[model samples]
Target: MNAIRQRIDTEVIPTPGPNPKNPLQARHLDHRLVHDLIARPEILGRLRALVGNDLVVWASYFFTKEPGGKEIPWHQDANYWPIEPPLNLSVWMAIDEVTTENSCVRIIPGSHRRVVPHVPARDGVAFGQEADPAYVDEDAAVDMVLRPGQFFLFNERLLHQSHRNTSSRRRMGLSARYIPPFVALLDQDAPPLFPDHACVVVSGDDTFGLNRTTNPPPRTA
Candidate 1:
């Protein structure tokens, strides 16, 4: 993984601007780094081991924090993902070193089982907060510090948040969301996949579409 990280960093250039999208930004849909990571046989095998053979690349994004970036408010990934059954996994790969000193994702283990009502995001907030008292347990949250190249896989419903990058160095990470091919989009009105239109291989030669049909119909009771 270290080699992979180094290759991506050396080959890709960072974008400019306060929140310039990272190298694998939404606009660079067919970027080589994106293709290398997603289409890698090892990654695909690992994903299949967990979610079975039929899987879909639901979404992908990059997060980078420079000095004084605002805190990513506490929230669950499921809150933003409009998918039914909530059976999805996220692979958070650290492009730059991550530690509590800078910016690292903090997760509440086993909190994935708790279904809390979604609270709308306040002005300038990246994610919504959990208002339910029962779901807010400060002690349970754990900070995940990863060395460049290391990655963590967690359930989409896991309660998590990231703090501001107080340190001088920048922190960067790439996040990829995956789901079984059977899962369905809960919100038909949700925005199109990042990059608007691009050919992303979710399964075999099938390119990802704005509104693609699922293999096994969404399990709606």
Candidate 2:
């Protein structure tokens, strides 16, 4: 924990930003940890329970929200995803102690049951898009405060968002997306939203041959 914390604190966080995309994507391909976590047997088994026995790691990302970082607007991960019927799920692994004061993730219960409309965000706030706060019972939204090394799984279409890092500590999380091979990504013929990424079959075979991938990017920068 100390080593990775120091790495993130020194190497990843404090990166020149005010960037529009999530901080995680910056190191998405640069780190071997991304692939290692996805290939984890326990993680793969759990993902199989949802999307079926066969699965592919479609995407992975890191979230390192520093103090004073902006709040992520209420939104669904599926809103930007290209998957059909949205069978995707994510495992958010905590790298640091997270809490409500430091902008931990929050989700609306049962919100995964449907897809809601999202509008473009204003003033570069949040994830560049947002769902109406009035759309859900904000009071009922659960705070996913986590201790270091803890993690949680959620559906991609689930209503979730995080707040600003008002507290003094840095908050970090790594998300790995999993889906069955039958599910396809939309808009592949055009410029893709997330580039420099490849999917890998962590467990079973990709019978549909729907994705292309490399044997994990080099770990050393």
Candidate 3:
């Protein structure tokens, strides 16, 4: 994690968006972190058990919340990704101790099974007020508090969001997405800004290259 942080600190600049200054947004740090994390046999073994061997990282994002950071509304991660079949998984690691006072992620249990319609993420943050009426059950949502060095791995389709950071200290986290290599992107024309080599699957034989391979035939309506 230190190596990854150093890489981001040196190579990339904090991407500015609708949010205030100090809200860190860095992509492609996965290559550095994966290289470091995969070296750990125990971590690799655990990832292999979950994602199998032939996996590729789909996307990654780092969120660093400055004091008084904004709130992230409830939503599902699959709503942002362009992959088909919605089989991706996310690993969210808390770089700093996170609590309800800060910005701990809240998730709706068993919400992964439901396919929610995509609502435009507010100001590029993957959260919004609108929700799929089909899956509105108040009892299912629960808060997830993570300590520094702790992480949560869950299906990307799970309904989750982070509340505002009311604390004085900064809240930092890394969110990485993984997927099977065979899963093709639904939007071939629109590719992510960062390079794809950042992804590394701990298990499976499949490998990813710079080549852009389209699905044999696009999904039909």
Instruction: Enumerate clash totals for all models, in the order shown.
Output: 0, 1, 3
List candidate 2 stretches off by more than 4 Å. Answer: 7-23, 26-30, 122-124, 188-196, 218-221
Scanning candidate 2 in windows of ten residues, the lowest lDDT window is 187-196
| Poorest stretch of ten by lDDT in candidate 3 | 212-221
Task: State which candidate has the highest TM-score.
Answer: 2
The per-model lDDT (C-alpha) reads 0.64, 0.73, 0.60
Model 1 CA lDDT for position 44: 73
TM-score of each: 0.75, 0.84, 0.72
RMSD of each: 7.2, 3.6, 7.9
Q: Could you give candidate 1's per-residue lDDT for residues 1-221 as a string of tens digits? A: 66755655555444421123334543124455554565457567778788777666656666778877767877777776677777887788887889998879998888888777767556665554653445668798898999876778888778788877789988888887777755666554335343222224455433334345333212220
User: What is the per-residue lDDT of model 3 for residues 85-106, given as tens digits with 9 covering 90 to 100?
Assistant: 6787777877677888887888
Better of 1 and 3 by lDDT: 1
lDDT of 2 by residue, 40-129 (tens): 777777787766788777676677788998888889888877777677888888888889988889998899887888887767575777
Query: In model 1, what is the error at residue 219, expressed in angstroms?
Result: 36
